[model samples]
Target: MKKEYFRYINTLFVVIPMTLIMAFVGLMRNYGFGEDWIIKFLKAWSVMLPVAYFAAFVIIPNARKLAEKITGKS
Candidate 1:
């Protein structure tokens, strides 16, 4: 893979588990560990994954800048 591909690869690695865990935790909290819980989590994760992946591209850079500004480090 090229260097440019790593950025997208990183996003996929980050987003998949992040959304999966978040979806699981959120639905578990709301609905408990019922039989339908995995189904619900799958539905939520599918929706969240792409949205979160794109949002990360926007949010991560700004967040890094903000952190640098706050901490006086870059």
Candidate 2:
């Protein structure tokens, strides 16, 4: 509806799946799968979520602008 509401929902939708996938891959890469892997994944996801949210809001718009400029897409 509103821009603010949409921003939050967008962040949630993007971050949740991304964090889940990346965290699983990263933890498994570093520590390997085990009973403790779930805990490690959740902890890493928790830490990453805020940073990812911040970057999505702050960086993505500028990045899109840069891409548009490079492609002359306007």
TM-score of 2: 0.85
Could you tell me the TM-score of candidate 1? Answer: 0.87
In order, what lDDT does every prediction score? Answer: 0.92, 0.88
In candidate 2, position 11 carries an lDDT of 77
Clashes of each: 0, 0
lDDT for each residue of candidate 1 in 1-74, tens digit (9 for 90 to 100): 89999999998999998898899889988999888887898899889999999999999999999999999996
Q: Which residue ranges in model 1 land beyond 4 Å of their true spot? A: none
Candidate 2: tens digits of C-alpha lDDT, residues 4-26: 69878977899889988888889
Candidate 1 lDDT (Cα, 0 to 1): 0.92
Which pairs of residues clash in candidate 2, taking residues 3 or more apart in a chain or in different chains?
A: none
Query: TM-scores of all models?
Result: 0.87, 0.85
